[model samples]
Target: MSDKITSIVGARPRGHGEAVARILSLAAAPTFAIMALIAAAAPADMLCAAMQGPLSLQGMVPMYALMSAFHLAPWLRLVR
Candidate 1:
């Protein structure tokens, strides 16, 4: 296909940087999930004892789980 047609259809060829970014993007979901799992399973007191104020696994676990859920769309699209 011609460049103009491919561009119009959102199929433009990817560059090296774009490829690298896509790879990193795909890895984001799993990374977030693993972080969330670790936070949820580990002893919260031990993990956040030194942390004061709002700095705690209570906040971080949900954030990481939410991030993992949000990043799952790309993988779902790939699967579909």
Candidate 2:
């Protein structure tokens, strides 16, 4: 049984690099959106506390917006 399983596993088709890239791109979409929303809504003080007082959440929103825009452009192209 183990030999049979191993044989089947070995016979399984391999994915192309593009497939992995697409999967990763899709996975990042929602994460970027969520991060954008969180950064936009989170208080700067809270972010500062979480970052041990080095970073500010006020800056997070713009950064997240840019990241979200970067992710969104590809998705929009895919959708169209």
Candidate 3:
């Protein structure tokens, strides 16, 4: 097997590039998740004032949640 396979069987050791990719993938999920949490806890007025115009937790929470969700594939790949 080449140095990219991550399966349980016939898996080869990871190369330097692959290792960096793995590390980044692992880090991305939590980073976005933390962003979502911070967004959820932030005051709506503060966000609105910073961004200008109308903004609310209702809009911000789900958008961040979706961003975090979109970054979850790396975690899923690790599980499999």
Listed in order, each prediction's TM-score against the native is 0.64, 0.53, 0.59
Q: Rank the candidates by lDDT, best first.
A: 1, 3, 2
User: Of 1 and 2, which scores higher on lDDT?
Assistant: 1
lDDT of each: 0.70, 0.61, 0.66
Instruction: Name model 2 segments beyond 4 Å from true.
Output: 1-14, 46-58
The ten-residue window of minimal lDDT in model 3 covers: 1-10
Query: 1-80, model 1: which lDDT tens digit per residue?
Result: 35554443343536655555555677899999999899777875754655635544356788998899999876776577
Q: Which ten residues in a row have the lowest lDDT in candidate 2?
A: 5-14
* Winning candidate number (lDDT): 1
Candidate 1 local Cα displacement, residue 14, angstroms: 2.0
Q: Candidate 1 — which pairs collide? A: none
Count of clashes in candidate 1: 0
Clashes of each: 0, 0, 0
